[model samples]
Target: MRFGPRLLMALGAAASLLAACDSAPITGRSQMMLVSESEERQMGLQAYQQVLSKEALSHDAQVTALVDKIGRRIAAAAERPPGELWRAPRFRWEFKTVDNKEPNAFCLPGGKVVVYTGILPITRTEAGLAVVVGHEVAHALARHGAERMSDQMVAQVGATAAGVALAATVGGSNRRYVPMMMAALGAGATVGYLLPMSRAQESEADRIGLVLMALAGYDPREAIGVWERMRAANTGKHTAEWLSTHPADSTRLADIRHWLPEAMRYYRPRD
Candidate 1:
């Protein structure tokens, strides 16, 4: 079962409810999450299947070879979930490229990955590709999507229950309800998802991705160059769908600087 301490703490103060908490790995901070490992695994697997079924796989041999080469290396370094799940040994991992023009890529909850060819020119090298792969893979290993959904669950349940509690303690009038609900929506977005995940999650990804790349024997520093190219590619606008979801490129790049010393400890320079 999952748990959220902040919500529980509020209840404890207001109505005497018990609270529990857990730390997010690497970052090591207690967070309000209540999603199970099994539930997250199911979501990842189902999402992977859906993406594969809906998207057209690319037949380009060059792209296929590049992805295969880089993907295996990154996966070998990623010693979590998708790897640890090798317990009963039922599923196989596959990497495929899709023939889309969008400069985008993602790794679903399972080990399923989709790389769009349009991003190739920006990546431009084996090391550059490793940087992209490592970050996306980090997202999956951290169970970010599950964290996102679990956050939604907490807000939905907490607000409904909390509002009524407040009404019982204070008053059951709609005057209090309207302003409270609107405030919850705005605050929930900033505190719930945006502020929580936006800064912290990107930092986590940078830390994990660098270690993964280092273990994979790509110069972990290549990630810096890759992001530089990524920024340049965007030209006039630094804001894009990828930037918004992942975090500001500047923030992420600065974070990369901070993690380099730690990541280098694991880096095995290529022979």
Candidate 2:
């Protein structure tokens, strides 16, 4: 029997999904990863370079050194244990401090980390800095960027399939409705799948970050305080957590508290 377009599209999507199945490090959460690691790293490097070219690097030697120190410690702690299902990528880790006033930080794929100077006040101590660095490092270590790209690929495929199905059903007379249907599908995918996935990844990063900081000899409990300070720092109105990619500050703090005990098991304070 000849396969219809809808049936064929379904099979193709299923096959692609099955072929790209991978797992996140530490958490073992299943991930869709159509992009190869090498490709992802190349993209990350390019993006990192682009950001550096546009932003002013911090000239404060002491603060720069501190970020580098903490980043190195956390990067070391991000290595996977021997025999783990997911092998850690060999990252050419580079940490830079930007002079921007925004309290933001991120670790791109292959361990390119950028920390804005404004976050320093919130991070006050070395341990507190570890909380931020560890979380950012966890994002790279877990390959979240690649997973997100994969999700977008899937979403695009879904939209295309929906378009195909709608075109056939609606015909040219009702063709005007196609764009509306596609828009609705896109929104549904964003709200129903992508947004929730992003929130989950953020929370996962928080949990893994706690463990990394603890393993690096930083007190995991310090994470709670860091987040609390972060919440305090941003006194402006915020978007609802469901619509935002990040968990609400209060939710993030609560999660760190809950994960503290698990992370404490890995804690071995440095003398």
Candidate 3:
């Protein structure tokens, strides 16, 4: 049998390593924060400006009201940033309805958000809209972007360390690992910019989002219908994939169901 002391020491060191990571405000779970807050906000601002300049926005009275109604609720309900570095000073929570048929939406750092007009029909109702906005806001509040960056950094560091160790042992270098530099860049985009973060992040968003919608005077039950409608609307070649950047629709819907009970705990209907 392996020695108990050695095993315990290993566990202790791992726990200590994890302690160095930052913790999110609401979940209070330690997270790997590879990028600073200012840089995140900077990218968010520039990206938002680029999107607005390039895309045509819809001026439908109903759409604007719906987006603003839900956005205000989610932003207000979300937990304030836990640390001093991420103050909500920059948050204005603007929601613009862009004329795109992509059935997509996003929240930038500092609370800038936009919904594509194509998503409106899928949303169907204000509460349904809340479900989408709340989920996006929850993503920001949890700082999933920075955590994803940290994950990429860790992966690269591991690759480089392994490459050095192999070179030391075999008295040779592995050129095959050279492509790994691209993998790191791809992984950073995959996790931080182009895709979602861990299962924990997704789960947390569902839980917190449900509560945010409820507090905003929206019916959280509408979330189920919202996703169902979204699933029905996607007639793309791969109706199998909801969006390239998000969790698989069925998996994400299931996760929402699993966390419904917990999310309800914080639900407070608006007066």
Candidate 4:
């Protein structure tokens, strides 16, 4: 019996996926990572340059210094043991504060961290700032961006193969149904798989971030308050949790509380 083209395509995709499996740091969650670290870092570097070119860097010396200080501590915590979880790759860490008013921050691959000045008001204090920075750093440490890229690639390939198979099965008589089926598949993948995976990664980042902040000698408990403030700030502006990429504020706070006990185990007040 000859194997059909669809079976061959599926088998190839499965093999590729299996070969690209990687485990995230601290959480030990398995991830699909078709993109190489070097490629990820290069993409990050290019994006970083583009962002820096377009966005104005913060001019407030004191605030900038404070962000740099907090970012350094978080980076150190990420590189060191227990938090490292394994012999992690060395990241050439750099932290810069952007002059934007959006309460946002992110850590690109290889540890390029950018904090918006707008988030400073929400972060409130050093420990509070650590909560935000630590969470962003956790995204980099866990390579979530690369995982997302891999997921998109696989989804696209699966969609293409599915479309081909559907077209062949329907031929001209039922060709009209093919596009509808493809759209349904896309929607199903986004709602059933990608969104949920993204939410899980967000929660995982929160947990890992709590540990990082604690290791950096910041009180992990501050994370709850910081998120509470965030909730207050965003008031009535969130999308439904199932449809959104990030968890709802309530779910996020609950997750942070749950992980706080474990994070506190790593805490040692900074002298």
Candidate 5:
């Protein structure tokens, strides 16, 4: 099947866009994912191995046990979707606490979760820990990382197209400036579009995490407390939501409050 160059380009672009279009579970939000689930898991496994090799895994039994216990409970709850089909069974869930001072936690694809030791002080209770862990888990379940990668992939394609167009329009000496102009365009796309997409993903994770924790028999209302404490903990250091890849703590807390009633319906208090 021989096709013209323009026809081939059009077909390739259409296929790429269609291949990247997917919907997130629970939230039902549309996502673009250039990578397959298996591919994402493989990348996650490699990243996990690399991280564990370089970073110090926590030795504190008490913290490690707490994180593991809460993580399992949340993972179990997340598996039982609310009448929605999902990819829980395929996950090879693992939880590890890292000996880091940063108040951060993340769950990679295939359920590889890492909790930084510094976040424990803010997440003082088991339920509080669930809030953080559940949120990280939600990011994985929602495939936000893959979506971000897809967005970057699309941006790279756009940059390449723009560079080609610039080359066709500009003269010899002016061609030298095309690289710098393309760099600026890439940066502008990242700051204007990609950052906002990331922030939206963070908000979606917050909403889904609340439900997961609630279903795990943790109090949904406690999510607010967790964010409130987080807000207080990072008072002077908080970035404006528009400028950062995450919603400001106060904004997150507000959204959590708004979504509490719905999350409450899933609350199944632990016996």
Candidate 6:
């Protein structure tokens, strides 16, 4: 039997989706990616600029110098001749130390990295700081954000398809309930798929970040110390928000410990 136009379209979409799956650079882990690197980079740049517009940048030259120094080194180390795991050789890397009290830092797509002043105490020396920057850059290098967006896109597409299928089964009177059913399905997808994938991404970043720092001439073992300090700093605060979005400190520390040996193979001290 010949396929209908709709059936043909669906088959083509499925084939395209399968073709879109890619492996991450260093870890070679399979990732569902629908967005293009250039598109993700553009979105990252826009978001980076918007964040800079709202957050106050650090005025202390010392803090800025340290962050820039470490960030540049990480970027250099992460940038592996255009075809490596950190594939975006064209990324115009930018680093800024934000004058914030929150112990947080992130690297946006296209190599935009921001460090909060509060994290400096925990990071301590330049090598310790390298640990943090390396992990953040790992997130960008792995294209975790784009993977997430791709996951969401898939969920939305599935949701829409489900809605259409449901509408076909229901009578006119029951058709009105399709939207409610779709909403619930969307919620379930978020809880079941998106959240868990985010946790995985965090863990993957931790793994790759260690290797990047080690390769960049920074001691990879310092990563454990940095996380230990972070755990100490976050002792009494409510962890629900952070834990929901990230791997627990203990879990991360354990993973770092497990991966340290492999990371060490890449380590070479730079003068």
Q: Count the backbone clashes (under 3 Å) in each candidate.
A: 1, 0, 0, 0, 0, 1
Residue pairs in steric clash, candidate 6?
25-85
Point to the candidate with the largest lDDT: 4
Residue 270 of candidate 4: its Cα lDDT?
Answer: 97
The true-structure Cα RMSD of candidate 5 reads 7.6
**Model 2 root mean square deviation, Cα atoms:** 7.4
Q: Which pairs in model 5 have colliding backbones?
A: none
The TM-score of candidate 2 is 0.85
- Candidate 5, after superposition: displacement of residue 206 in Å? 0.3
Q: Which ten residues in a row are the worst by lDDT in model 5?
A: 177-186
Residue-wise C-alpha lDDT for candidate 1, range 1-271, written one tens digit per residue: 6559776556553342112244554556455434444544555566666567888888999889989889887876675423342222122345779889888787655566679888888888898898888877776666665555544544555643643443352233223232322232223454435455545666677777887788788888888888888878878875553435456677778888888987788777775
lDDT per residue, candidate 4, 1-271, as tens digits? 8998878877765666676789887778999876667766666676677669889999999999998999899888888867337555577888999999999987776688899999988999999999999998898888887777566555665643533442343223332332332232123447766778878888888998998899899999999889999999989797898997789999999889988899999999996
Better of 5 and 6 by lDDT: 5
In model 2, what are the clashing residue pairs, if there are any?
A: none
Q: Alpha carbon lDDT of residue 32, candidate 4?
A: 80
The CA lDDT at 234 in model 3 is: 56
Model 3: per-residue lDDT, tens digit, 143-249?
66556545554554453242233234223332332223223222334434334445566667676677667656677888888877776775464423323445666
- The TM-score of candidate 3 is 0.70
**Model 5: CA > 4 A from native:** 1-4, 85-89, 159-189
Of the candidates numbered 2 and 3, which has the greater lDDT value?
2
Which regions of candidate 4 fall more than 4 Å away from where they truly are? Answer: 1-6, 159-192
Across residues 145-222, which tens digit of lDDT does each residue of candidate 6 receive?
667766765676673243233234221333233233223212344556677787888788888888888888999999
TM-score of each: 0.72, 0.85, 0.70, 0.85, 0.85, 0.84
Off by over 4 Å in 3: 1-20, 25-28, 79-90, 156-200, 235-245
RMSD of each: 9.0, 7.4, 8.5, 7.7, 7.6, 7.6
